[model samples]
Target: MPRAWTLRSRPNGMPTADNFELRDAPVPRLEDGQVHVRNRWLSVDPYMRGRMNDVKSYVPPFQVGEPLEGGAVGEVVDSRAEGFAAGDLVLHMAGWRDEAVLPATALNKLPQLGVEPQAFLGNLGLTGGTAYFGLLDAAQARQGDIVFVSAAAGAVGSAVVQIAKAKGMTVIGSAGGPAKCDFVRSLGADAVIDYKAGPLVKSLAEAAPKGIDVYFDNVGGDHLDAALAHARKDARFAICGMIEGYNAAEPMCFRYIMRVIAMRIMLKGFIYTDYLPRMGEFFADMGALVASGQVKSRDTVVGGLENTPDAFLGLFTGANTGKMLVKL
Candidate 1:
């Protein structure tokens, strides 16, 4: 018998382990054009927190008593699909389960990137895709631009820092602690702000006295307000995630939102799926960066399927440096 995590209940505020239940599930027989996979790695991301709520968003909300889903990399155990075979590694969204029986169309064959298969779930997958598209396409970051990134030690933020640096942009990153600030600095940030130390807006103002040309927002609320205040005229803002307010009981009010008009800031929210058509471009660019050691892959891996809920909960606690994963 295989085990999978189910959404026991909708979280009131911050999610707890009690909201998830691990139950034994039967692996369905492989039908035509279907394959059975034994997941090797499961991804736990901040965006999944939004999915837990019963809301109308880009993706549907997770249903109660049903298995939660996210990215997973696994080896094929049995296949009735034409293009796939036993022992082929694949990536899919049937995670939170030890084994998955899904259609071939749902699985993407992992490319031989000279890296571990788990890399597909981090630097070479959605994590990388989000950062790449968000920074380049959405934010339109250019060489010599001053870019400010929030949650700079997290998966997407770290990538944003590195990508901006690689493109010759001056980057300032904001993280929660000394260690995370150090990590962000190591990723080539011109300056790193310890948001936990003092007021975020004050720290950002001090770091960029001339105002920022672009803002890559991962943590919303105060971070967003800080970016709005310090934005240069006609600055571009790529709105990625708002992990700070994800579990909040009430909406966060922005005091500097009025500056959006005065500064002529372009704030845009985006989903990675919208850039799926350019996935080949992402792979070619990011793969080369990773291979050349320009863009590094960092992850915090929790062992076992049972701890998946803990890994997911850890996102809000800054328990992960980069991408968080569960080794199944």
Candidate 2:
């Protein structure tokens, strides 16, 4: 038997440590075409917060009384599938449980990249992949461009900065604290702005007087508006995550949306799963970047399976600098 966290209630505002409960259960068994995986690492991300409430969104909300679900890395402990065997590491949409029985289709065999295995949950996985595609394929950044990113110390945000920098762009990032700003600078950002200290619009103007060519938005609300005001002609905006307004009761104001019409800005919101077909190419490019030391992957490990909920809640409060993962 192993313990797992289950949703106790849909959160009304910011989640408390009590919105979830930890309980024990028997390890699941594999049926035909199914493989039983012993989870080793679990991801805790800001996107999961949107799925906690029973609201219409990009993905379905987490059902009440069900074990919370998200991305995880695990090893096959038993298999009823033909191609998989015990000890093979894989990635799946398995949630907060210690173990799971999933159809082989949901599992992707992880490559032995010789980096930390957890990088499969961070840089080598969807986080890095999202930054790669969203910026290159979607935003289409070019040489000598000015790029700005929000939530810039996070796993995905950090990757966006490095990718833009490597492509010869001047990258400016906005984070919450001086520590996170320093981390962003260390990642090769040309300028770092601490949004918590003063007005974001003024800071962006001072840092990027020529104006921004790409806006990789992770924190929305005021951050989004400020970036739009400073966007250069034909700028591209990738609306990734909106941590600033995740817990808000009403939608954040977008008074500057008129600028999109006037400026002809290409504004788009994306969910990484929608670009599944391009994942092969995306992963290959990011792999080479990591191999050549052009991009770096990082994780903040939260120990103990029982503490998973706290780790997930930390995403909203900026408690993590990179990917937040739980080690069992």
* Model 1 spans > 4 angstroms off: none
Clashing pairs in 1: none
11-87 in candidate 1: lDDT tens per residue? 99999988999999898777999999999999999888888889999999999999999999999999999999999
lDDT of 2 by residue, 87-107 (tens): 999999886989988899999
**Clashes per prediction?**
0, 0
Q: Please report how far candidate 1 places residue 23 from its true position, in Å.
A: 0.8
Model 2 per-residue lDDT at 303: 95
Name the TM-score of candidate 1. 0.99
What's model 1's lDDT at 34? 96
Compared with the true structure, all predictions reach lDDT values of 0.93, 0.88
**How do the predictions measure up, each by TM-score?**
0.99, 0.97
